[model samples]
Target: MSTRLDELVQELGQADRQERIELLIDLARELPPLPDRLAGSRDESHRVPECQSPVFLFVEPAESGRIRLYADAPAEAPTVRGFVALLVAGLDGATPAEVANLPDDILDRSGVREILGMQRISGLYGILRRLRALAAQLPQPESPAKMPADTPSADPPSAASSDPSTAAASTPDPEALIAALRTVTDPELHVNVIDLGLVYGIQTQGHEVHVEMTLTSPACPAGPQMIRDAVAALEKVEGVTKAHVKLVMNPPWSPDRMTDAARDELGIF
Candidate 1:
């Protein structure tokens, strides 16, 4: 039998883009408020730092030996709120192992990526990460009776851990981060920021990446979105836990900075 989350992912995968958005909005409306006990405790400590929206999560063991996940996100951020609600509905009653064993790419698998901006997607990833980390801290199930029907007793190791090459690639590297950023494009130009000479520098420390880049112009309207996209792209890399993007304008962007490919595409002589 498929879990509620598995069915939900299938539904999202089957829906058209517009219908998916509507479904997400409806799910957002379904997120219940934090219970009175946890209501007063939704402070900075419980907040998910990656989300731009004010989102908080709490996990507690249920009387039935399952775990309950409670989340709170403002009504204004429907996308994030919807994802939180979806998780709660799907996994709230699941055993710790089930929640901990969730696939890391559940967001992409659901096909919701099409409707979400890169920044929002990154934030949602953070929420999942936070949830899983909290789940890992819970006590493990001692017997088969504790496992839910949705979760199988025998489980395979995650690909990242099972594959030698994949395990090695999980650490953030300059090349990987750069390659990831190459996917972000300037909305107006349809040219990747990398080829457009928008990215100035990239630094990596452990799982974090720090970037310094400039825009076409100081007043470029797409600056903010571009920055967010760049950050999202970097963080999406297997090992990157955080991405910091800095905007620098001291050296103004000029056509001279564009890569040959970008110039050729733009028909610049």
Candidate 2:
């Protein structure tokens, strides 16, 4: 059998853009999610106590090449959403100095928790990186003013072949769309669709958008309802003319999807 990497490399060379993207989704299925909790019990780590409750974490990429990070922490459990957001923020282009010098007060604030549906600061930074990388590899944009100084200091080959208007029209601000998605609540879970892991990836191409997520239960009868709700939520976002949802079952769901913070709040250890 061909390994995912081998298949991906082969697919990369294919002429069809759709086929290459299909390979990306297929390869994603093979990736092992990051571990949620450290080994050992609360007795092992006196500094951080574990919750007696349960929590779950789920992440999915959007059509716009952004990821939706979800955490389901019942009220009974502690909420580590803030910490996860901070980690994500630091992952961005902020200079090591900027990230390191950040005040603890800012990190301790619950604003991050309230904004779980938004892109982690670092996630949007990735878009800036990719834009630059592709630009470097490809031809320079017709308008230099459109490029930000911090934008990919070293431009790579440009994957952007269209004009500035086409490029801007195609890309959606990852953070903005994520914030919009947070408003969507799972009809059954009663929490934000984001918290219930009902909203996964969001993708945008020109005026079209696609979201990919999975229901907690494979046989969920609310699948259609969830899809409708998600589409409705995304359509409300400005600049989105079309939206779609794809429910993926590959690799299955488990507590492993929970973030480090979610694990701590739930004491999943």
Candidate 3:
């Protein structure tokens, strides 16, 4: 199976122009605030000089026996912040070996080159180089023979496992599936597919699910990405084994289909 970073790369790589931008902004908002304990560590030694924005990063072993990354970037530089956030999310809690082995073309694989200018792209690579350097400072994990039998796993528990509504459901709940789908946003609208009324129907059979959905238009560039995202969301449900997404333009999609909240966000009133 692919690592979390690989999944993120595939998602960004498949996304349309508008969706990519929106996803990056969403990631920027998720960058954890630098903890007070590391406040003074923001010196030039920890900074990425190639980036126009002042960016600082630190890596350390976590209590869980995995790794943790802390970073700081100006709010004005959402693009930079977003890239940092992606690295942090994908690599945090990962084993040191995993971080060391990450591909150098990770940024290029994410399709970010199409979105950023050449200078910004160069700076992003610099950030990657700096992060790897910091991660290199950590002690490597010991051999299994030298470690305890109860060592913590590198992968974290899924969000679904923590939620009673999904975790305890004997069968896959349509509502749970819907909740998962809500995570998938329309690239152009920046509103979730659920709120946009793109999903026409959902059916569950045993551990499998089938969904019928539509796009804003047949020509919409972001349609494929939205479909892929929706499928990804559904499969994340606790009881779901597979998710099948079918595109249907027969009913089509319209502004009137948008929920009140989506309308408000778009100033559609």
Q: Estimate each model's TM-score.
A: 0.52, 0.37, 0.51
Ranking of models by lDDT: 1, 3, 2
Give stretches of model 3 more than 4 Å off.
142-269
The local distance difference test score of each candidate is 0.73, 0.41, 0.72
Q: Please give, for residues 184-265, the per-residue lDDT of candidate 2 as tens digits.
A: 6656666565555444355565454556667767987877887777778776777666566677653233332343332222
Cα shift from native, residue 26, model 2 (Å) = 34
Q: Candidate 1, which segments miss by more than 4 Å at Cα? A: 143-269
Note the residue pairs that clash in candidate 1. Answer: none
| Backbone atom clashes (below 3 Å) for every candidate | 0, 23, 0
Q: Which stretches of candidate 2 lie over 4 Å from their true place?
A: 1-164, 167-171, 256-269
- Candidate 3: residue 211 lDDT (0-100): 77
Evaluated against the true structure, the overall lDDT of model 1 is 0.73
Between prediction 1 and prediction 3, the one with superior lDDT is 1
Root-mean-square deviation of each candidate, in angstroms? 16.9, 19.6, 20.2
Candidate 3, residue 269: how far the Cα is off, in Å = 65
Best by lDDT: 1
The predicted structure with the larger TM-score, 2 or 3, is 3
